[model samples]
Target: MSEQPHPPKREIFDVPAMTNTDNKGFLRPVDEYRQLPYGLYMSRPADHPRFHHLESWLLPALGLRANIFHFTPDHRSGQRLYLDVGRFTGPDADGRWYSVDWYLDLVDVPGTELELLDVDELFTAHAAGLLTLDEAVEATEIAVRTLRGAAAAGDIQSWLDAQVGGRMPWLDRPVAR
Candidate 1:
């Protein structure tokens, strides 16, 4: 195969940027993935080896799926985020399948890196204390809100950079696998 080019990175906008107000643009209308706080939207986000009650049962109900998420670069914002989604299939009984989605922001700065995600593997990572469901939800929620706000507000590229704390070079070339 041929060599791949570098994608765009994060950029910045001016102070007090515009708000997209298009919350619906990020996730589905159903809001099935909306955060409920406390424990996992799928499993608990706290420490210890215990998931929060209903949270634990949710995994089995949805079936375990996995995903290695990726996001196309955005020239406007200058960052990369994963929209990884997967599904799980359970036994014949009730006939259920679970879905796990991730929206990890790109990080080359300190204390950050791309994380692996999937149904069982992702959950296992969460179980291993890799990040935690709460962290994931909080971060993703911020990302969705921030980006939408910036887009809607018509924030300049410079403002976008400050919001994400990095240049969005990933938007230049195609994203690597």
Candidate 2:
């Protein structure tokens, strides 16, 4: 019997760090994990101080990223999407903010985009008990709107080209350098 070949590893994510915490996200403690825009993300531990926790990823790859779905306002259609990970907290959880992560691929899902927030932020948000279902919907809706608008105006293909900095079929137009 021949063995099946393994799928190529996705560079989008960095190698997992060795830590006492053994959480790896696919669909996790937070179903909303699938709702944040593209970036690394994690959920809060059962109990921790600060009420929120977030760590940094390896260099270069550090940025806001999310897994989101693209779709119409009514969610009549949907597509899986992502943005590069960006944003982090200071030592004492000073100012809180999220940057405009890069544009991610939008595979067909339903036209209703799901924004997967950065894992670290998700963890922090969940830990702080600041996360809410309504907020998740709003996040996803924002990404969906951005994607739809970019597709209409053609800013995304160029942005996508910049994100990969390589030639890809997804670009409907010739990406400018």
Model 1, runs deviating above 4 Å: 1-103, 106-128, 155-177
What is the Cα-based TM-score of model 2?
0.25
Residue-level lDDT tens digits of model 1 in 1-177: 122322111111111221111112321111112111111122112221322111211122212111111222332222233322222222224322233333233221213333333334434445556556774454455445544544554442333344434442222332243
Candidate with best TM-score: 2
After the best TM-score superposition of candidate 2, give how far the Cα of residue 144 lies from its true spot, in angstroms.
Answer: 1.8
Let me know the TM-score candidate 1 reaches against the reference structure: 0.23
Total backbone clashes of candidate 2, pairs 3 or more residues apart or in separate chains: 43
lDDT of 2 at 153: 44
